[model samples]
Target: MRMMKMTVYFDNNATTPLKDGVKKAMAEALEVYGNPSSVHACGREARLLQDMARRNVAAMFGVRSEQVIFTSSGTEANNLVLRGYFACPENLEKGSKLVISSVEHNCVHKTAVDLNRLNGVSMHMVTVDRNGIIDIDDLKLTLEKGNVGLVSIMHGNNETGVIQPLDKIVALCKEYGVRVHTDAVQTAGKVALSFKDMGVDFMTVSFHKLGGPKGIGAVIMKADIDMECHTSGGSQERNRRAGTENIIGIAGAGACTEEWQVSVDKMQNQIGPLRNKLEKGLKQLSNELYIIGESTNRVPNTTNVIVPGLEGETAVMSLDMAGFCVSTGSACSSGRVEPSRVILAHGIPADEALCALRISLGWQTTEAEVDAFLAAFGEMLGRMQKAS
Candidate 1:
């Protein structure tokens, strides 16, 4: 039987395809050639567009419009929170500690490392369970050690799709009088977020992950938390972040958030069935396939499966050539062939860690695409089995 030809995309956790509405919104904004900071009618028009974008994003997080600060990307947002917070005059004292989870994205991990190297800051890493969730007791033990400046925990594990117990962590932080900062990049649009309810001191989100344009993101800070400005310039973002904003990208992010608010139910319905289909097909291909974090609560559209005796990079390449897009681990470090830190953190052997692959579905992923992937994936696995 001849297999059907298809171009299947399953790397939404890396980045998503821009929606038509978001593209249209960005195109419309691009026609307005005016700096938002200039004192003129054109500038006022641009400023209005920017304000609308802020309000749209704020609505998604249930925060005030002024509380959201736009940045170049999620990395910049993470840097601003990690570096900017400790650099503030109020927090510039010695012996300040910063705690982050073991499975954090490189943006968070590298930022912490850089701060420790340069600023004499104490960096603590919170351990995670086999399910990729931060061990709350360990976090409390770390918090009790000293004057904890910040607690940076991710809402969702980008690699394993495990959702952390954020509310419990936040409550514990409050009891200890510690400030919390959550990297909600992966969970922003896919899961429900309420700034008022989450009660974290700061939160970061990226637009590219949510079907919006790249190079634009937002950091939501509590109104009272005084963070030093990372980029100093004219009074934009209420003097929180500097530089003329990417107006078109901001507009696109706003459109994406608005559309998500209205169509979340539809998206949930569409992606869940496809994820289940992929999981079932992969398990049938080989019972030895270990699904990491399967016993824990995970995002609806992400699956991390370990194929024994096969290198993840080789499998990823084979699948890519077969017209299926997936990932070995973090897309930021995809070029490297090292075993994933996320998989290793789950107590998987170092050699076994090299066998993990992550397949994440998204809005444009269809049933036909998933079916095509299964057929190609089965063939690929059969070849690997025979060679081994």
Candidate 2:
């Protein structure tokens, strides 16, 4: 009789499985079944739950409860920040200008482009080095141009896991009187984030990225910064965002954040050893293979490697068939057979970018899973070598 193998998942950067505590919290909230905005006993109960969640999220970032505005997802939170900032009455008079890093996620890049096309906002690109770290000199030069309203840079690269120099960038922007926004979706729960200390004008985070339920996220904004409402009609999210509050999802997000705070130290210690083991095993198989963003400081759980002479999609499919799930790049554009823009921006050849695969670890991942992945990956590389 043939034996069936168990599947192993290594793509936590793309999305994480919901934590048990988060699920339980959401389930408890679901039983309330009341609109938080309505004025009644049930509504009051729902509103209290929402407020508690807000406080929890705020506490995570060392900000006031009023500063965290809930949104549907990280994408929406990002859009809200961009649109809200540009639409501000004071900024509207001077015409808005946007400066963003070349390696930012598509949501940020596309929004900047849209602002340029529709609102006559000027868009500038901040180049990054081969290590995927943004050039502070380039950012300063771009910000030096007067009339720069906002700078949007990511706290970390979603594909390469490279962390941007936020402290330096923020200081430069402050010197130029330009507001800064960071997409912290990748770094939020993975790292210890304090908005009050970070001092960015705005930062975006998503619950799904950190073992919480999907379709819920928040934007942490500085109290004094003025932002126009992107969604209108209701008095939800302190009039920052409209539509009904996602009470269940918000409850889950709070619970998830609380749990993360408890386990962050352990997670930090565990992921480094696992990543080193995986990288060492991969390197042993072939020295020709290279790790992208290896020269820069990066998140512990991620490793983006380029396998010599093999298409990333082919390798990803082969691993999938072997019961090991991984990704070529951003899961958003995974199906397309194109080189990753993040890789290309790092000055890697387009063909070489096509050979890159990203393997990420998670809190739930085990040592046995890593060992199994290494064994399977070695076998797959051998097969590819023979076939070539």
Candidate 3:
């Protein structure tokens, strides 16, 4: 049986298809050929382009130009907030406590653990419901325990497409006088984010997730909050992050963000219907296939299905053979054979978590691709089950 490979991409959460506009903007940045740090005309021009991109990225979050501090990636941005925030001399001595949601991306969760092990910082985790929504009541109770300096929650669950109720969490954190940060890497361009409205002390955004180039991201924080520099040496990014910026990647991200803001609704309109069609198709596949967070409000582009009687990695490989790209968890962690920690955090049994497959849509996903994937997936699942 010569089954010619038919590629259908459903792994946008791992990384999106590079947008044409973003590529063009990044190409233009190469012509500016000046050190953003230098005082010469070329340097000044580079600086101008960087600032313009910074302002545009900030605007994506409804934030001020000064608040967006560029970093190497969203992981770096998360590290800056978690580590940099505690690196403060006064705060370090206080034995400050930081809390993150149980289902946080590895960057946030691992950083918290490292801070606890290396710096002796106090850390806590607020649990989430089975649908992967942050347990607000549990969070309030944790805050009420007092001495919690910062609470980090992600705006969207990459695997499950579950969006946290950040407004309520922010208001609760404010009441407790604890700083709050959100890993918004998965949500920024996919949904509307109002920095002024959600009112968290810090937010992390990634470029690749915006359908832009990788290797660049930014942390948008309030004006009043100050942290020791995450990276030391020359003063760049208002003495916050100290590295020569990724001028090209920043330019691409800026262009991507701008394009998203203009056409977000169109993207969603296309994504929503296709996602619904896919989900409907999955339901028809078998009664045992469960879409995690099916009952809740999920970001339009993601679906996590627990295919019983199949290993997540097995399903991923089978789908790959069938010409569909999907994942078991965050791309960073998917290479390993571990069950999803995010799924485990939701109290799903380890076995079920190991069987979960995440299918994430993107701006460029077409109905034909969805239809193709559904057909291939259903066939693959049937074969896998028959073998069992």
Tell me the TM-score of each prediction against the true structure. Answer: 0.95, 0.96, 0.95
Candidates in descending lDDT order: 2, 1, 3
- What is candidate 1's lDDT per residue for 1-388, written digit by digit as tens? 9867438878899999999999999999999879999989999999999999899999999989989999988989999999999988687563389999989998999999999999878899988988898899998998777678889999888888898998999999988888999998888877778988998989999999989999999899898887888787887888888888899999999999996655465556778777888898889988899788888888878999998787788889999999998988723346666787778888889888988899998877888888898899899988987886
Whole-model lDDT, candidate 2?
Answer: 0.88
lDDT digits (tens) for residues 1-388 of candidate 2: 9757448878888888899989899989989899999899999999999999988899888999999999999999999999888988797565477999999999999999999999888899989899999888888887767778889999988898999989999988888888889999988877888887887999999988889988999999988877889877888888899899999999999998886675566457887688888999999989799998887888878899998688898898999999987998623356657788889999999888989999988888888989999999999989988988
Better-scoring candidate (TM-score), 1 or 2: 2
TM-score computed on alpha carbons, candidate 2: 0.96
Which of the predicted structures, 2 or 3, would earn the higher lDDT when compared with the native? Answer: 2
Query: Model 1: what TM-score?
Result: 0.95
The numbered model that scores best in TM-score is 2
Q: TM-score rank, highest first?
A: 2, 1, 3
- Alpha-carbon shift of residue 197 in model 1 (angstroms): 1.4
Clashing pairs in 2: none
